[model samples]
Target: MSAQFELPRDGVTRIMAAPPRLNLRRAASYQNDKGPLSSTSSRFNFNHLVFSPPPSPGLPPPLVTRPRKLSNAPRPSRVFRFVFWVASLVAFLYVASLFARRFVGHVPSVMSWAIESQDEYEMVGQDELPDFPTPIAVTDVHGRSKWTVSIPPTHTFPLSVQEYADMCAQCHEVAVHVRELHGESTSKQQARASYYYRDPYFVDVGEAESHGLLPGFSKTSKATGRSLAKPLIGESWDYMVEKPACKTSLTFVLESADGGLGTTLMLLWMAYGLAQKEGRAFFIDDTRWAYGRYTEMFQPPPPADCVPPPRHEMLPCPHGARHLVVSAGTARDTFGPAFTAQFEDVRQDSIERERPLFNLARVGYEALFRINKDDRPYVMERIEELKLKTTHGTNGDAANSTIIGVHVRHGDVHPVEYQYNGAYIPLTIYKERIQQAAVAQHNRAMPESVEPAPAPLVVLASDDPRVFESEEFSGVIRAQERIKLAGKVPVVQPVLDKSVMHPFKEEAVGWEGGFFRVMFWNLGRPSIASKQTQISLAPEATKLRAFIGRAYVMDLAVLGATSDVMVCTISAMGCRLLAVMMGWEKAMVKEQWVNIDGDYSWVAL
Candidate 1:
């Protein structure tokens, strides 16, 4: 309907229309002005508030004031920035240091495994004490399944001309078999036959006068300006025999233990190293003791990637090849499958095994050439030949208690799912197997003893059921049981201290497949019993452990810092050997699942 309209007077205005009729009971609706301000205030009524009219002529515009500038405010200092940068750098380094440490720490263990996984598993060959003098620590045996104790010292004679000659004759005496090898060349065989004879196994009496081409010492005894002419028939040949509280320490004391002089020397060297330097490499005064000339003579030989053997052949390390990791296997493989297959049977044959004699005949020669790098070529060539021979397999005589082995079996390589899968075998089963082997060896007259067994075998596996169960997966027991069965062990015993288990837990989430490796320690012919144990780790842990195994690879020049990422701190020489061994293993080495960020990659030992 038409209505009257009125308008406001200010520049901003609005019109009003009057309605003819009103419905008091109905809700009222009103429209607002069609301006920007009105639209912006659509939800608010600008006219709703009543205010007193501005004073008479509008009070003077509210007093205005300029705000002060904030440019003069205090700021952080340069020193603070510098300190921050330094702290950041340190933190970065600290983290990197941790990463490096994690990488390098795995090396020794991996190296140990590699060495123990060879065909000689329990029987590391007899190192020539005279030709190769560096001491090495052999991993103690695990799983008390057999009894072949290391022999005791055979003699402790005074270091004298006659005593020396007699001692030398014992080791140098040639057997008919060795004589046959020499065949027609009496001169050549003379050297071979006399090699062990000219010097006594324990006394250096003959060495002072007979060995050729070595440094000479002109000693003026402190008491007299003359040479120390007479042989002192005292204990400990290097030093004058000393009588402690009870008895005189003998000259040329015979080392009577599992490792003999080699181990003792290494321990001494290590102890000396630790005592002298915080982070320095191991060293010794070569000029002071019997090892002086030996170190100079046994320096490592040059690197040699020998020609591959014919399809059917195999070879092993020469007697003194340094940085060596020997394996016995078939032509198609790099480790001994035949030896592994015989593990079970060896126990059966041990019943009538003969006792072995302990000998340190090689010690003097080892001391003579210990670090001399010149003999390396011949040593390497011989080593290559040995490797090839071992690959082709050896006859029954090769089987002896002195030969201890660990069989690392790779899992079946079919069906991708199975490849990632792990099996569990109870520790009891392994123990039983060891017991059975011991029984068999005893039955065979191999000198087995009936002692209540202690832990002797260390089993390493990629898929350990125990670890999987910890992740809270369902039915872990079933999985663990399955693995135990596959492992061929029935008793479920944990070898490591329980405290170390959680932190060192090994799992197999990424183990592509499982493979078998064996480590051997030959204790002079048939003296095989020493400490033994088996450890099983899952795939991820296996890689770490395998890195430790890499140390046994003997070619240092070839083995550099390829595994720099795998380790944080290790002696430079140790690093080199680790790298070389990893290189030797090639594809068999484990993949690095753990890493720093996503950039760096891990290489072979």
Candidate 2:
């Protein structure tokens, strides 16, 4: 069917047509005139209605209105178009991000089965401390591992200082062949016999001063100084690889086994000391070390890429073995009066006992660790932030402020971990020592006049955070709480209480790794008393415990590198680490450090 109509304003002819239907029941189908519109709608009616309705003759003409404007687009389809553009934009951003990271010197983020990033497995390191520069958090240890480097026969290299001096005269090519390599000189790169060993046999207190064992007050104790260790740490990359390169190498490794975080650090420290003593290239094989990659957690060993010879040649005992491998398994066998300890001869003499080849180990540890630029500022920034929070008097101003570092041991540390027989010391002991040290520091900073001293700032770190709750620390910033100004002096904690540390309650048994375990295996089996009752985290607890380890690392750095007085128990290896890390001056020169437990001294591991 078809239809035509005339315009309302002008008379016009109109026509209509209808097709014949095969059956009457089909009836007449009709339609209306059409025009372009956003939405199309046609009337379906009987032809009879269109033919009969001329709209009542007398009725006022229906008011004409402009066609309703409409859209042809469907609601669902428009929504779909918007969604596609959004998805495309997101994909573009992701690709651009990948390129941007690489442009900034970052390698593509690696994915691994052993290590996968999970939201719940929070990052333990600070935003500034990348998981890079080596020492991964937690991974298995490599045992009986074969390496690619070839071993050298330098077994006779480290005999004695006299012999070593002669060897250096011949092998190292020093400018002047002095009879004693012990004469005073401030030049750090030059080899000094005292830099390597104190030689308990030939004891001379005055000559020891010339060895440059102490990084001068100019470097370690300067007012604007940022590090207490950088001056102590001296490494000659060229010296290690000059002519013969690695004359010898020390491999500090685990027997394809894991170790406790604290014990492993101490082991590496001892190994580095021995390596420096022998002028051996120090190499760390924390390959399967429980804490991730070696470089991930720490700066690489000096003479950075110097790989060790094959594992088969690495011997356990007899210190000067060409390739000495030191592990907890062989410490007793290897360190048998080799050095760094008071020999049986010194046991009777009080003076000898007091000075047990301290510089020997001091040389080693000083050469052991040096802080990086990224981490150098954590303590400094926090200290400045704290000083701003504090109200320092002129005598106790930040410029001359005595920054005190205190490490309190509790939780799983004290009695069980190291087999300590004495009861834990009173917190009051720390208070008294801190008070005493403050007065001493005040005296050191003040002139002979009678002016009030400035208040001291204390940096407190602990295995247990609850100690901060005691009355002695009331005005301090609690690890887990908001910082509030409460006292004249303020104590700052390494980490918030919960995001990282918690007092270790006696939990399920799971401590089955380390040299102790290797020894237990060698001595038949561990007795019931030897078994550990401490809590062992579940396999998935990696994310939970990682940050706490990082906080511990920062604590050591801040305490040893920045603080003026250190107060901690020497029984724990960690506390002893502070002794060595603080440089010999703190123990010898001014004696600013304090070992709260009167029973223990800064005994070398």
Candidate 3:
């Protein structure tokens, strides 16, 4: 059976999901699962101290020749001096309390992202650094938003099956089987005419619906649709999907080039949260997305039946816009700098400071993200296999081991995705934290018992394939053979184009599907990883990117749903989602979240 994590609507939700509830005592929810009972939590997040001063001594009367000359200026008396000293101490303590978490409070061991020193220097203009992306683009009040258009959630006019079929007659998929592209040999004919990656938006609504002539789809035959893909949750939605009267809708246009699946998901969640709070509609536009159809991987945004106002009626800025269209490019301008600073003045304690953002993030999780239809079964299979592989008891009969979810990201991220540095957390640091967690768990467990400590199983995910191959994680790493995902991360394979990567190409020797092989057609390709969307619309690259996207979602879902604890670098968007998925109680309160890069904080607009 597939892992069932359906969040209960109407004042209900399950664990590992929106019930991302507020607290927990143990790491894993399962009782039979045993490896650790307690983890290192901020049990004492901040100190609460009370101070008292000793009684002031009475001024000696006449013993001193104190009144010889009364100065016009008031002399410092014992009471005044004592009050001044007390005031200074209070001010000092106030400042100390602000940074107590980073200093006085117990902090999990932190590791650097192995960032290069040059990255620390502030960002230069786009023209100044032509080869790299700007670290973070500050929005301009007068500038036009990149997402100037908005496409309705429901097709503005339902695209009929016959019309779509007739329209897409030319340049249709020849069906040589895209999975064959992963094969070692590509025949000459296959190269000339075969399916590798379909053109963007090739799989239209009509092609995917495959059904009856009603308002909603009804399947009469066992025929599969044009696209083989499906979201982990809902495969199809109904006509007039949302309330007709809805006038305000938040459309998240994909800035497909900016970041990978993780970033897109995070931003979408943020949009969802904002829409809910503002009572606005929300939708996603993947027309220009490098990965092709949004529905190919996940469910469309919840119903907003009304079609969006014309592009002219839409506004880039959020303040006065009737219909809002935002992309990564327009986020800062839309939200403005004030939104980012909201949590800045909040408590520095990890949980409290993060509460405001976490609330919104959790709402996003509960409102939208769900286990898609395709990956549902695999989520459980992966978890069961991982637990079996890392059974913690000495007899090897223990139901499950305390687990740590680790996401290691080192794919070429410098100026674009991550601003802090072009650094990556080392596996050594991850290993140390896992060991530290296990030790802390033991201390919280029955310490008098002579049982040897059990090592927690590690469910690892990383962009670099080399990380999966590391012998350093052999003892803890358990899950085997995942979707090979990589792109510009200290790769060893000597390939032609260094910009984009295909893992299957490296694994399959003598394959000519290298990047530059399509050089003439790859014209105007951006050298930086972030801006490659210009030429990445190609079938091969997009398909590979989709597969890479699958790899990421799988890792995130499995680990988020099942892991006892998450030890990942919070710098990555997926890491934040993993925490959201693990439920706040377990991840935040019980201290199941162990950030290796730094303290816990979410990325803001």
What are the models' TM-scores?
Answer: 0.18, 0.47, 0.51
Worst 10 residues of 2 by lDDT: 139-148
Writing each residue's lDDT as its tens digit, candidate 2 over 334-360 gives: 454444343323654432363434555
Best by TM-score: 3
Evaluated at residue 193, the lDDT of candidate 1 is 34
Candidate 1 global lDDT: 0.25
Clashes per model (N, Cα, C within 3 A) = 163, 25, 11
Deviation from native of the Cα of residue 567 in model 2, angstroms: 1.4
- Name the 10 consecutive residues with the lowest summed lDDT in model 3: 127-136
Q: How many backbone collisions does model 3 have?
A: 11
Error of 2 at 18 (Å): 99
Per-residue lDDT for 1-605 in model 1, tens only? 87655555766667553332332221112222244345556555543243222222333535423333336654568678888999999999978855653443211101011123212222233322122111111211221111111111121211222222222222222222233433536565555432113211111211211221111131333223112222221112233443222110111212212211222232232222221222211122222122112223344212112211111010111111111111111111211232223222334343111100001111222222232344345435534433343344343223222111111122331111232234423334333444454344334443364543222211122222243333322211120111131223355656776566356442323322332122112211122333443233234543333232221222221112111112211112222222223332331233211121123232211
